[model samples]
Target chain A: MSEKIVQTSKEKQEETSQQISRQWKLSTSLGIMFLVIFMAITVLNTFAPDFMTFKVIGNFTVTYLYSVLLLYIASWSIVLYYVIKVTTLEGASI
Target chain B: MIEIPTAIGMVVLMVIITMGIAIFARRFGSSAAEFYVANRGITAFQNAISLGGSYMSAASFLGVAGLVWLYGYDGIWYASGFFGGYVVLLLWIAAPLRRFARYTVADFAFGRWHSKSLRMACIVFTLISMMFYVVPQMVGAGDLLGVLLGWDYTFAVVVSGILMTLYVVVGGMRGTTYNQIFLCIVLWSAMFITTILALMHYGWSYNALLGDIGARIEPGIWLDPLNSFALALGLVLGTAGLPHILIQYYTNPSGKAARWATVGVLFIIGTFYMMTPIVGFAGRAILGDAAGKNTVLPLLGQALGGEPLMGIIVGGAFAAIVSTTAALLIACTGAIAHDLYVGLINPEASDRKQVWIAKVSTIAIGLFTIGLGLAFKGYNVAFLVGLAFAITASTFFPMLFMGIWWKDMTDKGALAGLILGGASAILIITTNIMGMHTLQNPSIISVPLAFLAIYFVSKWAGKMPDDIDDIMHQMHSLHSDIK
Candidate 1:
């Protein structure tokens, strides 16, 4: 009976460790994705001046004001998604 | 121009109000922890407002507007980068840093690495960055006084320094936080009203103003890809490493609170930055090139709303300078009293003694900054702030990032990285000051070199600490198991 109890406890520890590793990987990937998207947009606005300067409205350019707004919204969405997912996961575990 | 008597009255009223808040907060700061982190009891919303107030230095208020007025589209790059930095801070540093819950960044470094040398290195870099950061606030104070009350630059710098020192010495972190929140409300109201009035002057047509600005912007000058990228990179990464700003996280109740506060800060700062362009564009169109660059916003206020409105704006500007200067002084005091004196010299010192030492150091730092500010009068505030950011980005950012995430970061590696990164940044900035303008923002090169130094040195010279696994677990864990 004691042997069986020890074996079960070992298995549970392994499972917990695996779950943590998976969460870490997912979180890191999400972070990297956000950074890449942010840097790419910045690069586009910088290198492609004419494209950014394409007049969208009367005086607003594609890259100057509008693109920045889009990037801001996208970044915030990414963060919000991460925050919700992580909090839910922690809640479920608890 | 603003009448001298009105400006003096406005400034005096602001000083009295701030001092009153400090006196009220004096009771909360009886212990070292209370002085440093407000006993870790500040709520997310209040901390967010205070953070916004501290972050929007004179550089943001006067400097960004001036740059926008002078350079048009190229100038908005500063605001874009400054706002984008919070995104990085929220995702990368905020949660883990708060989990550590140390008094200062040096304390964090020492705890993580168990190396006195690394802690000393952090203290040096912290002091350098804080001193450089305070210079711009001093300069802004002098400029505001000169424009408003017609005072000599040196006299203005000295007065501003003394007022800020008094605030930090009396109230410490609690006082600074309350005063910052009050100042931010005043600042935001003034900016909103000014932006509205300026738009009204242009008949509420953003397109008309944009059309004028677009016509004036020289082709290719406004959108140099390399310079723009450099500016953005420096601002975003540099913000991640600022000692004074990072210390604010410790005031939160928990890591989660810190994260939420950053989210709040994002919105608060974004709204303020958005109004800057309107102010800048309007100033350019109405005030023209005749208004001195640093005085554009005040002059624009007078033009749109007359002397009474200008007085309000000047009061807001002084508040911005004082709030930022107080934060910097507090950070400097922490480095001396908590990090050096307590951590290194006398670990057994009582809380009362530590607080006393912090107050003394605050006054000393204030006097030193006053002299530097006087010497650098008429220098561009934004440019000086950029250099401060570069130094911090190259030195502290790499160390902190690696220390928190990478388990293999050895003490030796951290020390090497800090020395190399800091030295390279100073050399490049000094050379730029001496007219070698090729490397204006050293982070573009220095950060990578610092990382490389850490990586190679750790691989060859030393092994990770024995307790690193536990440290890593603590940093990565969702909640504290101890509680």
Candidate 2:
């Protein structure tokens, strides 16, 4: 098998590859958004102790561990789920 | 506490309903997928609910409330740590494990390494960690049943064991997931109603009520900072490595479903966990010393609506225990069945046979847990879960993190880390804190040591593997290429 033959399929492969990477980007973006929320909580807690007592923000942060765990776990779970949905969507497109 | 007749009747009814669900769900197990990962056919919505149920275990139920009732403001760490742990789970673990491992956690362990020895190492560590997790649930069930229904501690263990085993054997993951979903809904409604009632009693001013309750309790116990940090660290880090929670990731039909489920799970778990502290704090203000620490929840409910409400509250706590217990049982059995029995013992076993083996193994483990529960009936629920968290954080967390991200992790290094992690954790549980004596300010001496051992051992294992870059690419690979 010539190297050229392998090289020739690269374009076709890239076509599919581009599609897949887009999904990964979406998942990664969602993941980072969740991290942002968690970081926000940490920042709020560090800078503002009184803020921790506010019912909306403070209540969530005061019970920070639960909110963090639930949010992060759910977010990651969403990413995995998106993988499945994307796979199925691609399969259908094919 | 509830009377004997009511308690026994409640116990019997709960058992019968659970068994019925198990038997009905048996039809879903005709195929291997149904048995193992529920055929990877579980919808994200169903899984999201199930995840919420599984994650919110005895800790969220009895422990948080009890701590709030006992320690006042300081107890919020229980809720905070648990929620925070999910962030670590999202960032470091979860999707990657689900994406890579097709079989079990053991399969993931063996994927990069060529050593059968390393595969066995992962299995043993997982089983040991899960066993620690199980004992507490069993003990909690026994204690709760005994107090609520006046059943002998032994009888409670036996009954709970039998019911758990029967369902796990017949329904497998399908049964476990559905049961978790059912149980979670019941628990959530119960807590919500209780919280609302508690708020209504004091005209719904959280600050006023908290202040009043804070006044009643001893000064330092209600709002200590250091205690919060340690509790937060344990709960936050512990979720990343839990055997059951990680295993649940594998059951998602597709990676997308798993991610979607995470979104729903966050909302459900986030809302419920927040409510736990509220319920606990309310109980503190209302019940006070007239009720024991664990009695805070039930007493408040009873005070709100007398016997009928009390029964419902107790029932909700019981439901919480059952859902988490069932999920743990399934996760532990998967470790034995998929990791050891199928992966190591009979590598060539057909999928059907593998499912059957899992069912049978679940029964055996269920029986074993019952014995441990009876033996440790007097122990505290939070204490047992913390020990579980410690062991898991020590052993599995490092292994999972390093195994996925670090290419240089050798068989010898992993084995050493796991053994050291588990042994040191067990030593801490047994010697530094016997039974449940030191639960209040539990010793976390072993936690840092476990992480340190893995880091140093892996560093010494030598240069990175030749395929390190390839593995990294696989992890960072774009979904479009696979699509």
Quick one: best DockQ, which candidate?
1
Candidate 1 - CAPRI tier?
incorrect
Q: lDDT of all predictions, in order shown?
A: 0.79, 0.66
For every model shown, the clashing-pair count is 0, 39
- Write one digit per residue (lDDT tens) for candidate 2, span B311-362: 7667666666767777788877777887788778887898788877887888
TM-score of 1: 0.92
The C-alpha stretches of model 2 lying farther than 4 A from their native spots are A1-94, B4-13, B215-227, B380-382, B427-431, B434-456, B462-483
Model 1 ranges with Cα > 4 A deviation: A1-34, B216-223, B378-383, B481-483
DockQ of each: 0.20, 0.12
Task: Going through the candidates in order, state the TM-score of chain A alone for each one.
Answer: 0.67, 0.54
Docking class for model 2 is incorrect
